[model samples]
Target: MNGPGGYFGGCLTALDDCLRGTFGYTAPATLLWRDASTAREHLSRALTAEGRPYDLFAGTLQVLAEGGMHVTLA
Candidate 1:
């Protein structure tokens, strides 16, 4: 999988940056997957709290999925 740092990798980096800025930390990809709902919830809350549109994150996830990324939420 093309991870953060490449052309197709910025999504994870973006997520990490967002999370770090909002929650003071970053989560491992595996852990994020393991607790997908909680992760999304935190992201949603943070984005809303910060006055950013939550659709940005949702759109990124959609793009990732369309790009063949396997992100199991359950």
Candidate 2:
């Protein structure tokens, strides 16, 4: 997996490579990404508003896929 190679390749493979190298996944993880640029503008300015300088996510999702459990949200 991770294919032992280049960029943005084999998502599941990367996870497999991670599990193999680490010997196992000690904790559950969620793997996701966005190429979106400036997309956050539509949301409340409060996210960056405080100058608190941190990221906040306000909801949740429960997903069962590929015999694995995943929870996804902002």
Candidate 2's residue-wise lDDT over 1-74, tens digit each?
23223332233444444444554443354545242223243322334445754222211111113324353423
Pairs clashing in candidate 1? Answer: none
The candidate 1 region of ten consecutive residues with least summed lDDT is 23-32
| Candidate 2: clashing pairs of residues | 1-13, 2-13, 2-14
State residue 12's C-alpha deviation in candidate 1, in Å. 6.5
The lDDT of model 1 is 0.49
lDDT of 2 at 68: 46
Top candidate, metric lDDT: 1
lDDT on C-alpha atoms for all candidate structures: 0.49, 0.34
Model 2, runs deviating above 4 Å: 1-11, 20-24, 30-69
> What is the TM-score of candidate 1?
0.41
Please provide, for model 1 over 1-74, each residue's C-alpha lDDT reduced to its tens digit, 9 standing for 90 to 100: 23343323345556544444543332333222556677577665445446776654476566455444456675
Error of 1 at 49 (Å): 12
Which candidate has the highest TM-score of all? Answer: 1
